[model samples]
Target: MSGGRSAQAAIAIILAGGRGSRLGGRDKAAITLGGERLVDRAVSAARDGGALAVIVAGPAAAVPPGCIGVREEPAYGGPLAALAAALERPEAATATETLLLSCDLVDPAAVVGRLSGARWPAGADALVLRDPDGREQWLAGRYRLAPLREGVTALGAVSGLPIRQALSGLRIAWLDTAADDVADIDTPEDLDRARARSELGAD
Candidate 1:
């Protein structure tokens, strides 16, 4: 992968430790939408986006080759804990920023491109996407590594910590996208929608 200013200094951290209770206990990382496993798609997106390193915060079984796999201290400790675990890795130490993503995203590559190519504002600690309903998709954001590490440190115990609380003090820059590029699989119905979108070449 060729590196650029934004992507070259970044580390992609993929959160894949969800319990998937709504998907009949299926592993979201292994789930396929349009014949591609979600975790594999995430890794491809990170590499294609030119991230210096890729880290999958999930079970070893879900981690693909050429990527680092790490588990949160308490398995299934939620996204914040997964992110905290990723930040502790040696790979993250040299990165200036982080591409925080979830393994369930239907179009991870598109989202990664959007974030990596966008003009990050000066003094902002993060650049996050806002879905159609105006809800912030925290996991679909790019964050300054220093601030993220500081935030995790301040939280002390990251397990079970709410994501919003964990990143409470960061200055954010929001990107509003009209498409469902940030849609993620959480249920059978969601999976069906993602498949339909994929087949339609919407992604």
Candidate 2:
């Protein structure tokens, strides 16, 4: 533990399997913000957050250096499927916690650091970040790996399952943060905003 924080070592698994239909079917993970691909930024943030390892759940070829990449079965499977696949990997098996993130976060490292540094309530299974509007950013959370694995195992054949369905019963602790911290790039205009924010050196 760092300064009374949880001692669990974290493995970051970034979900990058989205079809990006809103971005004209382009690979959103490869989209650039301030000259850096979204995937690359996510990887760097995870590292900065003290992740023991980083994995990208999507096209292997597109992932940044120093990160492993895996894909869910039946390409285009939803985030839950990608998460399930990530949990099965050897790195995750050895990890005490998992930092789950989507590729489009503008400040993933900050979210990861905040969640990792928090002292979760006794028996809490996860720590999820929430926007100012009180909307949970499910993908931007830190989960106890054992509970996560058990949850996934309890729901058999999770391929294509919606995240809300797959993770419904877990005990989640929510931390309310600025909307910008949890904002994601979905459309081109969102990308533009993120780029502008990046140029401003905003987290």
| TM-score, every prediction | 0.94, 0.93
> How many clashing residue pairs are found in candidate 1?
0
Which lDDT tens digits does candidate 1 get at residues 31-60? 987788999999899888877789999999
Q: Number of the top candidate by TM-score?
A: 1
Candidate 2 per-residue lDDT, tens place, 9-35, comes to 778999998999998998989888878
CA deviation > 4 Å runs, candidate 1: 1-6
lDDT per model vs. reference? 0.87, 0.83
Best by lDDT: 1
In each prediction, how many residue pairs overlap at the backbone (N, C-alpha, C within less than 3 A)?
A: 0, 0
Whole-structure CA lDDT of model 2: 0.83
- Candidate 2 Cα errors over 4 Å, as ranges: 1-8
